[model samples]
Target: MGRPKTSASGASKRTEKDAERALNADSKSPTSNSKKRHATKETRSSKTATSPSTTSAPVVKRKRAQSEVPTADDVTSNKRSKTGRPSKDQTKSRSAKSRESEAPALPAAINEVPQDILTVFVFGTGENGELGLGPKKNEALRPVLNPFLDPSSPDAFHIVDFACGGMHTVVLSAKNQIITWGVNDNKALGRQTDWDGGLRDVDAESDDEDDTTLNPLESTPTEIPAKQFPPGTRFTQVAAGDSCSFALTDTGLVYGWGSFRDAQGNNRFGYDTDGNIIATQETPIHIRGLPKITQIVCGDNHTLALDTKGDIWAWGYNEQNQFGRHLFGRQQDSFVPSQVRVCRGNAKYIASGPYHSFAIDRQDNVWAWGANSYGQAGDPKSAGGDSAVLRAPVKIQPLCQKKVTTLAGGAHHSAAVTAGGQCFVWGRIDAGQLGVVFTPEQIQDENSIRCDDRGKPRICLRPTTVPNVEQAVDVACGTDHTLFINKSGAAYSSGFGFQGQLGLGSSDDVEVAALIKAKTVRDRCLIRTGAGGNGSIVADIAKRN
Candidate 1:
């Protein structure tokens, strides 16, 4: 079924009025639901989050076969064999044999690691097994390797994109396939069944002392079938919400899975042809009725999609106007896509946080909306609001025409990159998410930057430049931390370090960006994830020496 129309004032009506009028005209025609278009948004909660770290700019990489391109039709057949992959016993036996044969322990660092050494390293709280490091090892206060993406191993696959939800992680491989692990609450990972007769558990509450064995969560990367996509279409991007997962196909079609619980307490799996909730598909289902989609991004509970026509549409949660719907007094959420009317100009980049959203227009202007409880919306004055919400998209004047290249958000912070690669961050600073320290004199300049009763900086309302990160190419955030990648492929991290999500090998929170000295072969430089996770995944490009 086609999606329902949103309120007329839903999106940025001022600039997108013409586009909305056109969409309105098309919505009246039956063909509107089937027409093709293109784009995507980028964020979420959880242990990690990632927006577009790589830009439209060219990156060195090998050519892939046309058939390998994932399509919306590739996953049409949902049928699968009862027995999936090798049994746990078989896997353990294989590992034991290999360990016994490959005896002598090598040096701590390998002198010659392959160029494609895609490593999945995680640190911090694995209490919920979000680290994917085996249940017994709940936390890695230090960066540890997953070994799943080790290029030196025969089973390794080159990971291209990664996203983290409140409790789960999803990785997209060069082969156009997806590998997901970690928390599976609400079937967010879209796994058909618990691997190995339920070694991974769903919706696990705590990392209790007695919880020692595997929790049915995939500790290792497991591929979800791509047969549901269009023929010859490969997945180009992936995203995660607090409890949902989304995939953007090369064909510009989006497929999403995971439950969307309603106020009535119904566990709705997916929308049917008519956009009504259906039983859990426990698998990826096509998100239809929108223009041809090019990009798909998610926040803690909401999603935003960008069309090639420069139009942005949002759905799901709107509790904090994260959908840019101006929803108030608990009229939150929209089951289907709705235009973000306030988003003016063709959005070249977009990002969402746990409770906020950001976009960079083709004109290099940056706009933000949703929750500003901690000045996360980039408005210093609103930091003291009774509701602390932006309600609609508003341009961050300080950054509007700075040639903003890209944007990112965390659980409670925002980031923007300029054409010159200068990175600016604002919002929650309690955890040092902004990657800056305020001297008493500087704090006095911005009234909203005063200290809390605990003497911690209340919030950074304006766009404060992150130091030592010039020429930053990409920006992403976790629940209370942020990451920046420079032109040289080096990464800098800051914020809550209790879980070591900062990649700094220590749990001490830093008031400034610090280089993550992760040991790797070549530069395992590309890092993504904009939510909370104790770990991260870095993909290696052999061609990008």
Candidate 2:
């Protein structure tokens, strides 16, 4: 919130006008992460057998601004979802209960994902920067302090993981590169910023500009330049949705880049330089046909990867069916990623919500698919009207009998965490986004929640329970809040906090789970947490001597 480089306003600073938010932003938690909430390990291509390839091709293709057509909801999802729908993939033995729940050798992601060295914390709205804090501070009701990602400064630099996008934020660098910031319009901050540039070229003192007006480079976080990739390109994971962005590569390729709107904003990315189809992807392309992926998730506009044989693929913006299949041309088949069988390949872990989708195969079964109106895709027989929407991927039956691990959601509600710590939650519940506390005879049951009309409750499809929140490990979702942490890092937050994003310093809303205590993240040893639509991001755990 500083500002005095000669009363600077380089890019004509705002006096108020900046409100227009919402383009669908953050249903992005590595599409389902905290490394799937812990226990599963094993991956580096299953201990170096190397074989699985298919890195697609593109990689850098820039040019954008095209559109080509395709939007009556993709010509009505290529005319009525191809055939009929409904299934949940049978049941009973359910593949021997998903092989008794793990250890066939495929769940490690370099030790469950978050590789430490981190150091970033933001809170509610930065106008469009979603609070990485800088463009002269747009907002932050609580957990502030992002001092250029501070690690004792001198331009320190560490990060390792981050996603939050519905406005922009993609980070992930312990040197592996890919740092983005807020709203590049639709480039989703994959790189490049300049609200106006050139105020005598202000360096003010340039440790990332603070002497004012170099215009906090879109709330500054910058990077994207390991010469743009191809030689030892590390990464590991990154996800964001609403306006697009993705990254995953410890070999299992996937690079993506902003632009997949819809619900009227109308968008698409990838395919320029005459390869046609373009509409936004300002940089970062490399999809090359898929397969060999491992895990990736982001549902605001769609994207789900998984691959390495366990298959899942899915492209973007498939109306409500969130791409469980069926499409005929309009989006040229949704931008070409394909293959979503959901079961046959036995996916091990995946999660997403903003539209819907989830996975957890290899015997621990727990699959779901796209927008089920308020059922939040947990599929209690597809909950509401028009069968709510599912179209394909089934098999959820209240998490078949638990053991879950990790799954999250928001903008309709969802949560799951099992393997001893439990957790469970379900859609909407009006607004407190289910941090638990029902019992007026459990909100009048009605086969597990649906109240409203004065009675309260309002939406939920099953999976209940959630109490005191034990060892959760991690869980996020912020179209209405959810946070949670546990296993000692302690953190909790419930729903719709006006924009304080439930960091618990106020801004209202909550129905149970509170605790975040503020003061710039209360002494921080905190493990991880992310959510973006309005704000919330916590990482901590960096200290060392």
Candidate 3:
């Protein structure tokens, strides 16, 4: 590790002297080949000048006189003659110069893809291979690219936004289109109809007579038309939960598919609409009374929608109070959209974890409700022991003061970014989903805890800042991992890395945070941290010019 000692003083002096003599000889002879030979002899002599055999006494240090210094042109010509080819150092210098000349000038503000092309983040219970493309049955190691992206087609593009359920995937396209693929059980597929002989069962036994065959319409990417929207209405966003799908239109209207249950335990479709609750539809139907909606999100068995006026509404399975309403002792469902005054002021965005929900107000304040089993509701010190399910929205005190600009939820964890560019993560740290912490206390606590049925470390209730990160613009959480995108466009991820989801090109997952570098592009780098059941995070950095 120490620096190598420099050549002995006498040897260095002699080498300098011989170099001077070679330069003078080359300059005097000009193009003479014999002059080059003399330069070579001088260079060789310089190498032996420090040999102990050639020196018996201390030599006085002498600087070469100015007149003896070779002119630039003379040195250049001599260097070319002595060496048949350019030296590695010279070649490297030339390459650097060329790169500087060819560098592309970037503008003050880089052009971003239109909102329609916004990339999506998908996470869910992959423990059953619900993520679709991953090879595992459950718990995706990381976010993976949707297999639907056709690289061979010029017009083909990756999904802009998508949602995953226990066994289904719903995606929205860059063109404001909706596509659903995966398991169709529980009428999760919005389009299911009753057709006796016309039905061809997709998953039925080939020989069972009463198998009631329904064509494999629910298992593939089926496009849903925008019929429920006002004429010419365009979709802006879409979200899917365990058994339902919610789509928001540009006109601010919200549409839903699957099942619609009311607060009185009555099935709305059974009364007003001639449809079976178990029947799936290949089409989308407008939610009973919601309009002017700005955003929509879903939880394992509930839904949340924010209207243009910033009002929040929710419905569906309220068992865990995921529906942020004060409906206690009510086994009845809210088939129609109902308002929930969780947080006052204008709502900007909403997110949902497996059994919890989160919202960001116009001021960037955060509010959360539903299951707090793993502190997914954002209370770090609460011990998540609340038996009184929050049927109404509750302000998450820790995140209430931080101007949260964005939010993402994993199966049992939640993450958010502040306007000031800091990232806060809480909830499920098992499987190292939360980025590794280097703090001595955290390390010691982790070592002391024994892995048990509680499932490794329970979710962190308090918002802990991810270590060694700054200026993080966006943060996303996978079922068991997390990802952060910085202002420089570099992506960093931590957590499970099975199946190369970390993009580290190995299956050895990281227990602590690590920088991920992609080899595909030299100037631009991509690092993915996080897992989505079976999917891996995809970080696409711009290539260097």
Best by lDDT: 2
**Distance (Å) between predicted and true CA of 524, model 2?**
12
> Model 2 over residues 276-372: C-alpha lDDT tens digits?
8878887787877786787888877788888777878788777777777677665456778777766757777888877778888887879888777
Q: Write the per-residue lDDT of candidate 1 for residues 1-545, one digit (tens) a residue.
A: 11112222323332353253343231112211101100110111112322367434222111111122112122223333467666666677678778756776432321121223245556655544566665456567545666565544545655666787766777777666777766564677777534332222334445554434444344446678656554445667888865678887655777888754433334554478765666455778888767767777887667888887778888775657777766445333376677787654488677787667888787777888887776777877677443578867888889988988777777567887877889988877765778887778777765647456656566777788887887888887776678787777777788866555677777677878988776641356553333444454443353321
Could you tell me which 10 consecutive residues in candidate 2 have the lowest summed lDDT?
Answer: 1-10
Q: How close is candidate 1 to the true structure, as a TM-score?
A: 0.71
What does candidate 3's lDDT look like per residue over 1-545, in tens digits? Answer: 00001124423544653353233221111111111112221231221234346653333221112122111111122243255787666777688778856776432321122242323223322322244432222333334343444333334434555555434566666655576654443355565522223322233335543332222343235555444444444666667664467777665666676543323333322123543353333346666666567678766556888776778887765656666665544424455567776654477778777567888777657888776655667754443443324555667777787888777776556888887878888765655667755354553463322222444354465677776567778776655556677656566767755434454445554666555554332234333232333344343422211
For each candidate, give its TM-score against the true structure. 0.71, 0.34, 0.60
Instruction: Indicate the residue-level lDDT of 378 in model 2.
Output: 82
**Cα lDDT listed for each candidate:** 0.62, 0.65, 0.51
lDDT of 1 at 234: 64
Q: Kindly give the stretch of ten consecutive residues in candidate 3 with the minimal lDDT sum.
A: 26-35
Root mean square deviation (Cα) for candidate 3: 29.9
Give each model's clash number.
63, 16, 47
Candidate 2 Cα deviation (angstroms), residue 462: 14
